[model samples]
Target: MENENWKNIRVPRVSSIEKCVAEFDITQLDVPSGRFRIRIYENTNGKFMGFTNLKIKNLFDGYPEGGVGNGNSITEALEDTIKNFMENLSENRILNDSDFIFVNYNEF
Candidate 1:
Protein backbone atom coordinates (compact mmCIF):
# COMPACT_ATOMS: atom_id res chain seq x y z
CA MET A 1 0.00 0.00 0.00
CA GLU A 2 1.16 3.54 -0.64
CA ASN A 3 2.25 5.65 2.28
CA GLU A 4 -0.51 7.92 3.55
CA ASN A 5 -0.03 11.53 2.57
CA TRP A 6 0.83 13.24 5.81
CA LYS A 7 1.03 16.62 4.19
CA ASN A 8 -2.69 16.74 3.80
CA ILE A 9 -3.32 16.27 7.48
CA ARG A 10 -5.01 19.12 9.29
CA VAL A 11 -4.41 19.80 12.93
CA PRO A 12 -6.76 21.60 15.29
CA ARG A 13 -6.26 25.25 16.06
CA VAL A 14 -4.82 26.28 19.37
CA SER A 15 -6.89 28.45 21.68
CA SER A 16 -6.34 32.16 21.21
CA ILE A 17 -4.98 32.41 24.71
CA GLU A 18 -2.29 29.77 24.27
CA LYS A 19 0.71 29.95 22.05
CA CYS A 20 2.17 27.11 19.99
CA VAL A 21 5.85 26.79 20.70
CA ALA A 22 6.85 23.97 18.41
CA GLU A 23 5.43 21.34 16.10
CA PHE A 24 6.64 18.16 14.42
CA ASP A 25 5.37 15.40 12.20
CA ILE A 26 6.32 11.80 12.91
CA THR A 27 5.54 8.79 10.79
CA GLN A 28 4.29 5.56 12.34
CA LEU A 29 5.37 2.40 10.49
CA ASP A 30 3.23 -0.37 11.87
CA VAL A 31 -0.40 -1.44 11.89
CA PRO A 32 -2.68 1.60 12.23
CA SER A 33 0.36 3.60 11.18
CA GLY A 34 0.12 7.02 9.67
CA ARG A 35 1.44 10.52 10.06
CA PHE A 36 1.22 11.91 13.58
CA ARG A 37 1.52 15.53 14.66
CA ILE A 38 3.17 16.72 17.85
CA ARG A 39 2.43 20.17 19.15
CA ILE A 40 3.86 21.98 22.14
CA TYR A 41 1.86 24.76 23.69
CA GLU A 42 2.70 27.41 26.24
CA ASN A 43 -0.12 28.23 28.56
CA THR A 44 -0.77 31.88 29.22
CA ASN A 45 -3.39 31.51 31.89
CA GLY A 46 -2.13 33.24 35.04
CA LYS A 47 -2.42 30.12 37.17
CA PHE A 48 -0.73 27.96 34.59
CA MET A 49 1.90 30.32 33.29
CA GLY A 50 4.87 28.01 33.61
CA PHE A 51 3.07 24.89 32.50
CA THR A 52 3.25 23.45 29.02
CA ASN A 53 1.13 20.91 27.22
CA LEU A 54 2.21 18.52 24.52
CA LYS A 55 -0.33 16.89 22.28
CA ILE A 56 0.06 14.15 19.71
CA LYS A 57 -2.60 13.73 17.08
CA ASN A 58 -3.02 10.96 14.54
CA LEU A 59 -3.21 12.92 11.33
CA PHE A 60 -5.08 10.11 9.64
CA ASP A 61 -8.03 10.78 11.89
CA GLY A 62 -7.19 14.05 13.60
CA TYR A 63 -7.55 12.53 17.04
CA PRO A 64 -5.39 12.03 20.10
CA GLU A 65 -3.73 8.72 19.33
CA GLY A 66 -0.83 9.24 21.74
CA GLY A 67 -2.59 11.29 24.41
CA VAL A 68 -1.40 14.50 26.06
CA GLY A 69 1.52 15.31 28.33
CA ASN A 70 2.12 18.10 30.78
CA GLY A 71 5.53 19.38 31.80
CA ASN A 72 7.73 22.39 32.43
CA SER A 73 9.83 21.78 29.34
CA ILE A 74 9.58 20.40 25.86
CA THR A 75 11.92 17.47 26.52
CA GLU A 76 9.84 16.21 29.39
CA ALA A 77 6.68 16.42 27.33
CA LEU A 78 8.27 14.52 24.45
CA GLU A 79 9.42 11.75 26.77
CA ASP A 80 5.95 11.51 28.19
CA THR A 81 4.43 11.30 24.76
CA ILE A 82 6.77 8.47 23.79
CA LYS A 83 5.84 6.51 26.88
CA ASN A 84 2.14 6.96 26.26
CA PHE A 85 2.42 5.98 22.62
CA MET A 86 4.32 2.79 23.44
CA GLU A 87 1.75 1.81 26.00
CA ASN A 88 -1.09 2.46 23.61
CA LEU A 89 0.52 0.43 20.82
CA SER A 90 1.28 -2.50 23.11
CA GLU A 91 -2.19 -2.53 24.55
CA ASN A 92 -3.57 -2.95 21.05
CA ARG A 93 -1.12 -5.80 20.27
CA ILE A 94 0.50 -3.98 17.41
CA LEU A 95 3.92 -5.36 18.24
CA ASN A 96 5.54 -6.16 14.92
CA ASP A 97 6.40 -4.44 11.65
CA SER A 98 5.93 -7.44 9.34
CA ASP A 99 2.35 -6.71 8.41
CA PHE A 100 2.66 -2.96 8.06
CA ILE A 101 4.74 -0.18 6.56
CA PHE A 102 8.22 0.71 7.80
CA VAL A 103 9.97 4.06 7.62
CA ASN A 104 12.70 5.74 9.59
CA TYR A 105 11.61 8.65 11.78
CA ASN A 106 14.44 10.75 10.39
CA GLU A 107 13.33 10.19 6.81
CA PHE A 108 10.52 12.70 7.23
Candidate 2:
Protein backbone atom coordinates (compact mmCIF):
# COMPACT_ATOMS: atom_id res chain seq x y z
CA MET A 1 0.00 0.00 0.00
CA GLU A 2 1.19 3.52 -0.78
CA ASN A 3 1.94 5.94 2.05
CA GLU A 4 -0.79 8.48 2.79
CA ASN A 5 1.07 10.80 5.16
CA TRP A 6 2.76 12.63 2.29
CA LYS A 7 -0.48 14.53 1.68
CA ASN A 8 -0.30 15.90 5.22
CA ILE A 9 3.33 16.92 5.07
CA ARG A 10 4.31 20.56 4.94
CA VAL A 11 7.61 21.87 3.62
CA PRO A 12 9.49 24.10 6.02
CA ARG A 13 10.51 27.53 4.76
CA VAL A 14 14.03 28.91 4.97
CA SER A 15 14.66 31.39 7.78
CA SER A 16 16.89 34.45 7.83
CA ILE A 17 16.59 35.44 11.48
CA GLU A 18 19.75 37.13 12.69
CA LYS A 19 19.16 38.61 16.14
CA CYS A 20 16.56 39.78 18.56
CA VAL A 21 15.81 43.50 18.68
CA ALA A 22 13.28 43.83 21.47
CA GLU A 23 11.59 41.65 24.08
CA PHE A 24 9.01 42.34 26.76
CA ASP A 25 6.17 40.97 28.82
CA ILE A 26 2.45 41.10 28.16
CA THR A 27 -0.59 40.04 30.18
CA GLN A 28 -3.86 38.69 28.97
CA LEU A 29 -6.85 40.56 30.38
CA ASP A 30 -9.46 37.86 30.26
CA VAL A 31 -10.31 35.45 33.03
CA PRO A 32 -7.90 32.54 33.58
CA SER A 33 -5.48 34.67 31.62
CA GLY A 34 -1.72 34.50 31.82
CA ARG A 35 1.40 36.40 30.94
CA PHE A 36 3.58 35.95 27.88
CA ARG A 37 6.84 37.27 26.52
CA ILE A 38 7.18 38.76 23.08
CA ARG A 39 10.49 38.85 21.31
CA ILE A 40 11.19 40.66 18.06
CA TYR A 41 14.26 40.02 15.97
CA GLU A 42 15.90 41.18 12.77
CA ASN A 43 16.13 38.87 9.80
CA THR A 44 19.19 39.91 7.84
CA ASN A 45 20.26 36.75 6.08
CA GLY A 46 18.46 34.20 3.76
CA LYS A 47 15.88 34.18 0.99
CA PHE A 48 13.31 35.35 3.58
CA MET A 49 15.44 38.14 4.98
CA GLY A 50 13.45 40.89 6.65
CA PHE A 51 13.40 43.36 9.56
CA THR A 52 11.39 41.57 12.19
CA ASN A 53 11.60 38.25 14.02
CA LEU A 54 8.25 36.95 15.16
CA LYS A 55 8.50 34.91 18.35
CA ILE A 56 6.61 34.56 21.59
CA LYS A 57 7.11 32.64 24.83
CA ASN A 58 4.80 31.54 27.58
CA LEU A 59 5.87 33.31 30.76
CA PHE A 60 3.91 31.05 33.05
CA ASP A 61 6.16 28.04 32.51
CA GLY A 62 8.83 29.14 30.08
CA TYR A 63 7.67 26.77 27.39
CA PRO A 64 7.60 27.76 23.73
CA GLU A 65 4.04 27.76 22.44
CA GLY A 66 3.08 30.19 19.68
CA GLY A 67 4.65 29.34 16.34
CA VAL A 68 6.57 32.08 14.45
CA GLY A 69 6.27 34.79 11.83
CA ASN A 70 8.29 37.48 9.96
CA GLY A 71 7.57 41.02 8.87
CA ASN A 72 9.15 44.26 7.65
CA SER A 73 7.88 46.52 10.41
CA ILE A 74 7.00 46.58 14.10
CA THR A 75 3.30 46.68 13.39
CA GLU A 76 3.59 43.77 11.05
CA ALA A 77 5.58 41.86 13.61
CA LEU A 78 2.97 42.39 16.31
CA GLU A 79 0.20 41.43 13.91
CA ASP A 80 2.06 38.27 13.02
CA THR A 81 2.59 37.59 16.71
CA ILE A 82 -1.11 37.81 17.39
CA LYS A 83 -1.98 35.69 14.40
CA ASN A 84 0.41 32.90 15.32
CA PHE A 85 -0.49 33.21 18.96
CA MET A 86 -4.17 32.79 18.30
CA GLU A 87 -3.51 29.84 16.07
CA ASN A 88 -1.63 28.16 18.88
CA LEU A 89 -3.91 29.36 21.63
CA SER A 90 -6.12 26.83 23.38
CA GLU A 91 -9.75 26.42 22.44
CA ASN A 92 -12.32 28.91 23.82
CA ARG A 93 -9.59 31.47 24.37
CA ILE A 94 -10.09 34.96 23.01
CA LEU A 95 -7.38 37.50 22.26
CA ASN A 96 -7.59 41.20 21.50
CA ASP A 97 -5.67 44.44 22.02
CA SER A 98 -7.81 45.61 24.88
CA ASP A 99 -7.62 42.18 26.45
CA PHE A 100 -3.87 41.98 26.19
CA ILE A 101 -1.75 44.49 28.04
CA PHE A 102 1.88 45.19 27.28
CA VAL A 103 3.57 44.97 30.65
CA ASN A 104 7.02 46.12 29.65
CA TYR A 105 6.76 48.13 26.49
CA ASN A 106 9.86 50.25 27.19
CA GLU A 107 11.96 47.80 25.22
CA PHE A 108 10.03 48.74 22.09
Alpha-carbon deviation at 42 in model 2, angstroms: 0.3
**Cα lDDT tens digits for candidate 1, 36-87:** 5556655543111111122334436545333456667766665565556555
Quality of model 1 by C-alpha lDDT? 0.46
After superposing candidate 1 on the true structure, give the runs of residues whose Cα lies further than 4 Å from its correct spot: 1-16, 31-34, 45-65, 92-108
lDDT by residue for model 2 (1-108), tens: 243333344457933234555565556543124656667665443111112122233546544344355677655676677566656554454544343333334443
Top candidate (TM-score): 1
> Each model's C-alpha lDDT?
0.46, 0.47
Evaluate model 2: give its TM-score: 0.44
Per-residue lDDT value at 47 in model 1: 16
**Angstrom error at residue 98, model 2:** 26
TM-score of each model, in listed order: 0.46, 0.44
